[model samples]
Target: MRLKPRQLEAFRHVMLTRGVTAASEAMNIAQPAVSRLIRDLESEVGMTLFTRQGGRLLPTPEAVLLLAEVERLYIGIDQVARAADDIRQHLNVVLRMASVTSLVRPFLHRAMMEVVGPRLDLPLVLDVENSRHIWDMVEQSHYDLGLVFGPPRQGDLQTVHLHSSTAVAAMPPDHPLAEKDVITPTDLLDCRVLTAGRNSPLRRGLDRAFSQAEQAPLNTLETSMLNCCHFAAAGMGVAIVDRITMRAADVKLCAKPFLPTIDVSYYAARPAGSRQILVLDQIVERIKELLDEDTVIAS
Candidate 1:
């Protein structure tokens, strides 16, 4: 039996909110109407979608799997609608972009907003994924642009340098090392080092710095989450993090420039033959403008 789009929407809402009352509020419908929609959907599918236990709605495995597909369908529907609106208004095409987690929060997103401002009629779709995941999506032509922390070695992709910044040693404000204006890798040899996962470029730089100092590999605490590195530094463990990450006001971490700075580069990559390369080039230019502005103001 084919499920109606409205029924699928109701199912997704219930699965997301996990409570009929919450789903009803979100859908802007009465609770009884929401319940009826769910019941109809379950009957049409010939299966129980959610399990009720202790007043909590738990999704069955089948329902969870279906919810994932429904999310993608809805995202595509939204994109189509926005594209139509953009065409009607004679607006520049919306460029779908994806970026690694490292550039998500304050860098790439900020730069995009500054570049487009309120002038663009089409909504830019930005997806944040890990570096490897973003590259895979780029290979599939799922995104027009991909922002990554490191260079792309593949021949099929063309990359343009966007910005570069040096990594700094971060420590809690009250930590002993915070008193120093500049920190060296040797200074951290005896301290616990908080770093990103082994595969991340930031971690690779940290490793190289220690190797150059001829120190035993640091007592590393590896984490995949960038926020965890911030917290680790705030809690007294020394972390080598990009300058943008050290700027969080709530972190209470003092950043000291590394004696031999580790340079990190950001690149915008696009399929070499894709027509969307023009959009990527525009974005890369905007990124350079912002970085240059920051450098001039700082100087």
Candidate 2:
């Protein structure tokens, strides 16, 4: 004998509420109809599910086991219903992204404008961190997408090179070295230099350039953010940063090509073996296009 949907629903409600009256009230049906559905469910399963005691119904051991399975089935059905609702209303969908601080304002802003429109009504969860933190979060699967610079970490991650950018020396327009088309390590020797910390690849590359040039850079401040460019624009010191960091047209700073160029390659990374999401893939593509366009314009 086949069990009907009403029979299973009535049985589940009774098992949950442990009372026929409550089950009937919950299902918006008469108590007699609830009893008939429960009776039909028991007959279809060919087992006695409950026993009457003191004007109350007590579930038998078999009924308890059956109720566990019925709850699991209902949970699956509820999930399907929620998924359908989300599809209909475009709810509960968020794109989680992690990126280095420098990439957040310029790179991501341009990519979002190109891919998701400038208004960006879609739910986007963004985390700004250092390059190392971005890589670690993406590697651990805490972030759905990561934008970072330099070589990507190996193992358990899929990376695609977005583009490469060379380092630039940012200085106030009136700074003495700003007259030079390209700033050398020797040009930084006498100036108070704003630098990235030792953890940054650009810092290490610059250190090597200084070593090879046999000049000592007088580093006045060390920071990880692109704010160093703003400081340079404010005449604090000469700041060496990625070319992208100098792209803001309002900064009023001269970005000169740095000598012994440090080429930092940016990458779009995601956890390996994760299911491909269409939106994330499109975002990656848009970033690549924007970066390529910037490269062309710079050249």
Candidate 3:
């Protein structure tokens, strides 16, 4: 039994759209043409792939199984298209990477430039996402590399430590604690505080510090680490953030050392692929160097 590309396309579209009419619209073809393709495909496969139900076409078990294989094929087709595009653009190499949003500007750019300088034609697809999503994206092979705060926990990833720094407290310029060179957890007593979300390593350390003081912050707002400075500048509360996030010199906010310091680790993570890209290695090396410089400056 031979299956034509149009027949498979129609079957895939109907399965995705769940109706001949919708599939026709999606594929920019007439409904009759779509139905004919599906019919031909079913005939070739010798199985009824869909059942008509109340104006909606539901996939039978065979159709569901077929669609899985079709989807895998589509993924390969997409990769081919991407490679063609890279060649068309005259890119020497293409590397897809992702990182937490906060690192996009101050961190990722610097690292990338350090490695790929003067080669602007080299294509780099960078996905900016939250730290929580970085691991899953890398593990799924959605991104070739990921730069993120904290250690890599997933078993599928090969991770390297890039930097380590202590947490710092950020407050509005005029906040009472701003006058202090180093503000400890107790110094924030009776004050509203902003911190990383509950699952964050930084938040865990902040919680421990407050617990040691036997005091709960008067109020707490949990948010992205990058937003901590924004919250502090807005006078929402004092924010606890990593040294990387705090290293920015902001006139609107004052950063001070946190007592009972919490250590934050940054890692360069990649899926354990059979082939490693040399560019990815260079990027990680640049990141390590930059972070080391930042540490020396802070000290």
Best by TM-score: 2
- Which tens-of-lDDT digit does each residue in 1-299 have in candidate 2? 77788898999888889999999999999999999998988889999999999989999999999989988989999999998886554456677898877666666877776777753436778887778888888888888899887777879798989878788888888999979999998888788888887878888888888888876776568876377888888888999887766664238888888989887778889987866766778888887887788778977
- Winner on TM-score between 2 and 3 is 2
Segments in model 1 whose C-alpha atoms lie over 4 Å from true places: 1-94, 115-123, 248-250, 276-280
lDDT of 1 by residue, 226-245 (tens): 66456665584777787655
Worst-scoring 10-residue span by lDDT in model 1: 243-252
Can you rank all candidates by TM-score, best first? 2, 3, 1
For candidate 1, the per-residue lDDT at 39 reads 86
lDDT of 2: 0.82
Q: What is the lDDT of every predicted structure here?
A: 0.74, 0.82, 0.81
Q: Give the TM-score of candidate 3.
A: 0.64
In the predicted model 3, the residue pairs found to clash are none
